[model samples]
Target: MRHRRIGRSGLLVSEISYGNRFAHRESANCARAALEAGITTFHTAAAWGHGAAEEALAEGLREARRDDIVLCTGVFWLEHPGASQFGLGRKHLMSSLHGSLRRLGTDHVDVFQLWRFDHRTPLEETFLALSDVVREGKVRYVGTAEWTAEQLLRADALANELRVPLLCNHAHYSMLWRAPESQVMPAAARAGIGHFASMPLAQGILTGKYRQQRIPPGSRADNDERGRSAVRPFLDASLLERVDLLRGIAEEAGLTMAQLAIAWALHHEGVASAVVGASRPAQVAENARASGVELGIDVLTQIDQLLGGFVQSDPRLTFTPTQYDDL
Candidate 1:
């Protein structure tokens, strides 16, 4: 697997990091497979399965060398204390990190991210809490996910003010969703922050498996709440037609729809890593192979035509909850 540094830091990660949100049941095997596949980076979120995801990942890493796997997780919610497994407040961030470390059976994590942009709290307050964690050695790096370009810039400014290093932003950017091309990607590039594209598969929509009309049994689309909600807005004829066209392009490229979809995400220069979640080991290997496939200019141009080329942010054009506020 190809590896790259996160942001401008010396910390290196695989091009395709293993996403642990849905790998809970078989996390041990998943981690073993990832190591066999040369994927050393693994990421999870506190809100995913309400901490079961991280716990599973911890269990998986037990069999692997501690230095071989880089672990990360985010505080999922910043609302009421009950809303999140760990709120973003100083107290909550510390308490949550300790609990996460204990669960993972580690003293420190490679990266700890804020799962969402908390509009309710001052950005400084949150950044400060993260800075404290870094100083105390509980978290090696700090990052954010699903935040706007403006919010990311402000975060960097705050990090600078506090002398804390802000590493990256985790967002969803795929052929079906390219909102980051306009603001998020450019902002991260300018601020010297890495951009990790989460959910490059669009909850299996880009895999062409769903074109069969029904979600396959045991697939993320069939089992996860977010997966189900994400596909709801795209039930219209226009979007479905677009999806079909994109699938045709993938066929011409001699690639599975999954390969084309993942390659489409890696094609973006701003993306430092693409975290791929798989339910099975074979699925993980398939995604890892796409790291060798790169789309040339001609294929990318054809793809642009199918994807409407430009970033479209009409709230009316959302495909899922993750795509809802994309702009």
Candidate 2:
């Protein structure tokens, strides 16, 4: 697998990393397969499978050296009782990290990210808490997930003021979802922060399984109701046409649709790593194969035209405003 430096850090990670949601036993096998395929990075979230996924990954790491795999996890959806589970309140973040440590079977994570930007918590409080983790050696670096460019800039400036390392930001980016270019990618590049792209396949929409008038059996659309709902607004007739055009490009390149999608993300200069979530070992292998193939500028331009002018019009795009009353 090809390796790239994560932000300005000397640490180099594989272009494609493994991600797990809940498949404990299955994820263990997947990790092994990923290691065999030369994928050295693994990402999981505390909220993933409600923490069961981290437990399984920790169990899998028992067979490998700690340094052999670069482990990362985020704190989101932890039980916060009175406070919102999504933010970075001190009580909530401390409780959540302890729980994540217990589940991951590690005291420190390579990169500890907040699952989302906590608009509620005072930036100072959140930054201090993150700095404390690094100071105490419980986390090597800090990051945020699903945050906008403004939030990232504010956090980086805070990190600079506090003399702490703010390493990266994690968000979803793929051929189908190119929204990061407008702000997130540029902000990260300017601030020397890594941008790890999640869901490189657009929740399997770009996998070339769905066709005109036929949704493939066992696809995310068939099996994941929430995923289908999330894509409904974007899946209008025009987008379907775009998907078909994208399919032709993939076919011409002699690669699978998933491979082309992942390659698109990895081809970017600003992307530190593309996190791939797989249900099976074969899926992990297929994703790892993408690191080797690079899409040329001509291919990217064609894809841009085919998929341009699309917006995330799904209802889920506008989430309930974050709770800041407690702060």
Candidate 3:
């Protein structure tokens, strides 16, 4: 696996990270498969499967006995309901970090990210709490996920002021979701913060399996309500035809449709990793090989032109209008 440094920090992660957000129940097996497939990084969350994901990941890593790998987890998703239960407040952050550590069966995680930007809490409070954990030997690096360009800048500055530089800004970047490129990716690149691309396959639509208006049995579009919702937006016949055309491109590039999608997401200097979920070992192996695959400028341009209108680019759509305005 090829390694990329997270932002300007010494922390390095495999270009392709195995994320267990969707397959938390099978994470132990998935983690083992990931390590075998040369994936050194694992992305999980505090509330994934209500903490089952972290524990399962720990089980797999323990069985593998590899502490030299990067383990990344996040805080948010309102793990519980309480006045002080959520957000980036010190109380929640400190307690959340301890809970994550205990569940992962480790003293610390390599990257402890603010999974959501908490407008309710001061950015200073968030960074201050993050800095304390770094000093307490609990978290090595701090990052953000799905934050806006403005929010990224504000938090990055606050983190620097606290002497705990932010490492990466992970966001939803895929064949269909290009909104981050409007401002988020450039901002992170300029700030020397790495960008982690989540959902690089556009929730499986770019994999070509959803082509010809046929949703395969047991696919995300079939089983998961949330997954179905994510995949529903691209179900138009014209868009499905455009997605099907990617099969020829993938063949010409000597890549699978999924691999082509992943490579495209990683085809930037600022993007450090593509976080993907897999259900089986074979799927993990296939996704791992796309880490270092390079695409030419011609291929990129063709892709951009093929899926023109279906792609999302508006920065305001990053979240709700009211929420984005507040950010």
Clash counts per candidate, in order, are: 1, 0, 0
Looking at model 2, report the run of 10 residues with the lowest lDDT sum: 311-320
Q: What's every prediction's RMSD, in angstroms? A: 3.7, 3.2, 2.6
Task: Say which candidate scores most in TM-score.
Answer: 3
Residue 180, candidate 1: alpha-carbon lDDT: 71
Model 2: lDDT of residue 278: 74
- lDDT per residue (tens digit) for residues 52-152 in model 1: 77788887777787777788887745323344433456776777787778777888888898877765567777888888888988888888887777788
TM-score winner, 1 or 2 = 2
Q: Write the per-residue lDDT of candidate 3 for residues 1-327, one digit (tens) a residue.
A: 899987888888999998887545566788889999889988998877778778888887886554678889998666643333776788888888899999888898888988887877788888888888889878888889888989988887887788885889888888788888879888888888898899998888888888777778977778878778878887889999998998899999999999999999999778899999877668899999998899999999999999998889887666412242322
Ranking by TM-score: 3, 2, 1
Winner on lDDT between 2 and 3 is 3
**Lowest summed lDDT over 10 consecutive residues: which window, candidate 3?**
318-327
**Local distance difference test values of all predictions, in order:** 0.76, 0.78, 0.84
Model 2, 1-327: lDDT tens digits are 988988877778899998877654578888888888898888988776677888888876677888877889887565434445566878778878888888888878888887777666798998888888888988888877877778889988999998777878787887767667777777888999887888888877788565563566755566677767765655567777787788789989988888899999888788888999776889889888888797888998998888877734232332223764533
Candidate 2 C-alpha error for residue 66, in Å? 0.5
Query: Which stretches of candidate 3 lie above 4 Å from their native place?
Result: 22-25, 80-84, 319-327
lDDT for model 1: 0.76
Candidate 1 ranges with C-alpha deviation above 4 Å: 78-86, 309-327
For residue 115, give model 2's deviation from the true position in Å: 1.5
